[model samples]
Target chain A: MSKQHESVNIIEVKDVAFSFGAEKVLHDISFDIHRGDYLGIIGPNGSGKTTLLKIMLGLLRPESGTIKLFGKDLKNFREWSKIGYVPQKATNFDAHFPATVHEVVLMGRYGSRGLLHRITGHDHNLVRKSLEQVGMQEYQHRLIGDLSGGQQQRVFIARALAGQPEVIFLDEPTTGIDEKTQGEFYALLKKLNEDLNLTLVLVSHDIAMVTKEVMHIACIDRTLVCHMSPEEYLKESHSEKIFGHDVKVMTHHRHKK
Target chain B: MNFLSLFQYGFIVRGLEAGMIVAIIAPLIGIFLVLRRYSLIADTLAHVSLAGIAIGLLLGVNPALSALGTTVIASLGMERLRTSKRVYGESALALFLSGSLALAIVLLSLAKGFNTNLFNYLFGSIVTVTSADVRIIAGLGVVVIVLLVAFFKELVYVTFDEDAAKVSGIPTRLINTLLIVFAAVTVSLSIPIVGVLLIAALIVIPVVTALQLRKSFLATIVYAEFFSLFSVIAGIFASFYLNLSTGGTIVLIMLAIFGAVMASRKG
Candidate 1:
């Protein structure tokens, strides 16, 4: 691909407005997600952060807005294989669902493989490679329910990676895991962002962690409050303005290698 | 009588053939239904099929065909109601189950009260199964199997995580509709051997028993298939020589197996 095409915006949201019944949830939300952008969406509770991500993934439609994915209108865009999704691990699925880790990850290939097609050797290879990428290759044969919360999240991430998507959307991916596993998960995401250059959209409640890790922060509270780099967002007064309080922006220090 | 002697009777032979086919396909649909926690759907559709059978008897048509048509349409309506969230899933099922049973009773009374034909359908009588019935069951069973195989992965994915499957472009709505239609077909086809009252047990008990093994999804289906076939075959033979109700016998055998499995697992 040419440099111009590579640098084009992967997602474009314009004039998006949505409501649940009588109450407005999101209003006048407009933003562009460029290639290789690790954008973290953080907001107060019931602020439509997950809803915004769902709208972008076409899970929920904005009442009034236009969404263009890969320059194609959302309604007409059918190439879903180019994008992947890992929903909130703790709440989205049945923990005891009778799927092996290998089977769960293999589902990521189904969109690209199309309907009525058999799983080929290539598909299996991709599943294996995705498992390996998440460091869960040894547990591929284990039932997904047998794994811990952190391990299951990694399997879900591996499932998204199996699609070889240009972008992956994660909704509260580290909600139930321990602090150590959460750090490892963030490291894995950073490695994917920096090494593989994959566009990422993370919906999270941990503002501090997100601000420290993500390249861009989109603070959403009923609307697009600010879309800027973390440093710029922290320097500005936008955090307190959206949060409705004097938010203390703590910068956690890590020992450099 | 020897085991081979049963095949000498044409009705017994036809019953076994149709029963075995239903046994195989029931679990194929049953595994998905059981895992999705929609087991009551099978029973609800079975009741709907009874109303269809009543309509067929009144109109002098093939009861199985009319039953298939009615259940398929009712299943679609049930799906609509459930998806619309206008009615909770269990509530929707309750509405259809009782509504159709009432319809069946009124229609049966209109057709001149309880008769042998209706009784045969209520509790299965394998002796009444004809070559034509076997042919119909075989033909429609193939359709159910083919559709299940074609959409196997999509169905599993949707059953696992519906929202993720939708995001992956799997046409989750269509797949869900297709599954219920398959269930309708399975329920209708099963009536000749398993009866309206007991078809759900055929469709559900084996899957439940298999689930106790805690295997992978595909392996669970395989084990369910084994249990279903075992129950059907043994139930048919036991009913034949012992003068028992085929549907009742089949369900009892299934319950026995389920009891044994649970007991063994505990031990």
Candidate 2:
């Protein structure tokens, strides 16, 4: 949780704006991320954390401004090998999809394999290696739907890792997971950061957990209010500024528990 | 005996061949239909296409061609309805089904001659099918099936999660429209071989049977194909040997297979 890596400038967002019809979601938001930056994006519900991540990944078109990854526009750098995404706890998946964990993970390789290319031995090895990395090698043949929420989250991370992307975007990757699993998940991500130097940008409402996990934090609420280290963002004064007056009562200094 | 002679004489070869191809493709499309929760879309399109064919009779054009055109138009409407956010896909399909059937009834009443041609369209026959029909069925079957296999991964992804598919950079919207288009056209053309009432059975039965035994996506497709082939062949020969209706017999065979699979799965 230290501000260690500072020179890479891997992602650059300039004056980004987004809206659904007439109502705006992100307003003139801007930010920059460098290599090995595990940036945590946090905000209250409906704060456009997911939308901002989607725009960064080129999944959603911004109403204005530009987003660049590794000096190239995001839309232009969609070599699946260069990017990874773990959508917010894939709860929307149909339980009867009939695909095994191995098969689901293999789909991550499809973008890198290009159109009409079959899953090759290299892709299979990478998928297996990703599963092993997530400690899910044992569940490789099991139906994805049969897994627990935490196990399923690991599977999704494995899927993202299978792409071998430099930067991975995880949309609230720890939702509905137990506290023990959440701690292990954070440790796993930290290991990825230290060992492989994988860049991570995650969205979540778990401020305390994210402060313990991510190094840099973008505390968002309909705008790119400020970018700071998690500790600074967690300061008593900053928390009030970010969450407004009502947040003071949330941490009431009640003498009795 | 008279109907048996049609198959025994080989003069009815084209219709029999056409029936064989449609029987296979209907179930292939049906697998995705059921997965996407759009299984009823097929039934609706089949009924709508019937009205289109009836209109064709009133205009003296080929009923098959009109059915294809009208189904395409109806499919476009279904897509628009699905996109409207307020109207669910199932309700849209039902609306089109009811609307088309009513139009067809009125149109059929105005046609010059109705009984035999309409009966053949409704119940299907080996006697009235032409070489052109067989050729169309074969070409469309090959193209649709091949396209499906070629885009197998994308199809599977979309069938399970449309939003995920779109976010992953797959052309989910285009693929969605294309699927309904493919379904509508295939249903329109296939109904001439399988009656509209039983087309749903042909589409649903094979996949249901395959799903009982197969867990993987690819295996399900292959097993569905196998199930379809079995039902069609058994239905054809049974209908030929016993002098029964080909369309009805084929659907009954599929339904029997479905029932057996359900019973086995339950037990």
Candidate 3:
């Protein structure tokens, strides 16, 4: 909201398009993420939300257009440690993976240290601090697989926080958590955004919750239908357009009661 | 027989030395492979190593060296084929495994016949280990262990989540290449001690046993090496007293240990 931070573009996507064989996933999508922006990308299933996030993260190459991260082209961007990512809640991780919470979080430091470098005391302190920030410090010694889904998500968020990244991208983080846990999870994200000044880009299908939490929303269905403030999106009725159906946008206050 | 008497013979000493070295490195390699769900690749590479051994013997070179060379190529091929997105990783392994087995059989037949000495390489003979074999095992063990320690962090990160590792700037492709190459070296080097048919057991069983205990990653690795060393040492003793196949005895010991671990967990 500050005038000085208005011009800072943490992420800029220009006319990006992607397709898997004949099925076009994303087409000519454009968006901008300012510094300290809490961006929520929402869409229906198979609407290319995850694909756009992957393109921005450089996991998937777009068929066309350019992405700039922190004012540097994504291809040339070398400061990856400054950007953190928590994938869709460890669905790919084995439940019996033999790693403790502390060990899992320590992996975040691997990017900064490169190969062959030993983790210093400063790094260990940061890991502890990150766990503390996420209020999971006491469970640091527990096995990652032993934790519940919500706890695992917190540990993952702590893992991302350990790197001290300026921005973080999360993909469907609250997939399996209960409603109470989801509220707690959103509150944690809100705190991270407001207190630490961490820019966030989260992709989710929970339109009502996401619109309430994020300052800006990007509705995508193959291409970006609109990128506007949550209030503006609700007023303009972008949900029906994005979902390709008569969707209702219930305000967050309805859910609070 | 006294333990000291067992060590008096040069062949027994060499066998023990090489077996111990193989025991250490195989589990170290196995833990990563199992964690990454690439355990089948171990069996595939082991089978491929046989073709290398056969080719080496046909050309009057050291079979172990030839096996190493062949496995390196085959392992790299497996990695490439899996990444091509044309086939599933398991399917790729099956293709390579069958291809290598066919090549081994052809090479064996072309080399006049499956002589008893060459047969020893396939089934493993503890009494036939040379000083050269001992040196090679020691050298390879040191290199693998050193490289593993140096890249431990990166490998762990990559193994847990490859996409996250790549986005984190860990050079996942290079790390994956390193893992497969190390796996090749492990399988090839293990051929002299456990033979082609049983090398996968030496690399995989101990890690599987460790995973059942719910230990942390480093603890899992340490326990795997311990179980591996136990199986090799005990199997050597069993082979010495019972006059059984060294590699077969070792694998059986591992299987027995696995059964016991699983049973205990059930209990």
* Top candidate by lDDT: 1
Error of 2 at A206 (Å): 2.0
By DockQ, the better pick of 1 and 3 is: 3
- Give the per-residue lDDT of model 1 (tens digit) for A1-257: 22335577999999999999899999999989899989999876678999999999898889999999999999999999989999987667786777899999999988888889988999999999999998999999999999998999999999999989999999988877878999999999999999999999999877878988998889888999889888877777554665675345312322111
lDDT of 1 by residue, B128-183 (tens): 88888899999999989998999998998999888888888899989999999999
Clashes of each: 0, 0, 0
Candidate 3 accuracy as lDDT: 0.89
Over the stretch A1-257, how does candidate 3's per-residue lDDT look in tens digits? 33344558889999999999998999989889999999999877778998899999999999999999999999999999998999986466788899999999998888988877998999999999999999999999999999998999999999889888999999989887888999999999999999998999999888888988998999888989888888877776754555656355322222210
In terms of TM-score, the best-performing candidate is 3
Error of 2 at B257 (Å): 2.7
Candidate 2 pairs with clashing backbones: none
TM-scores for chain A over all candidates: 0.92, 0.91, 0.93
Q: What does candidate 1 score on TM? A: 0.95
lDDT of 2: 0.79
| Top-DockQ candidate index | 3
For candidate 2, what is the DockQ? 0.38
lDDT of 2 at B2: 66
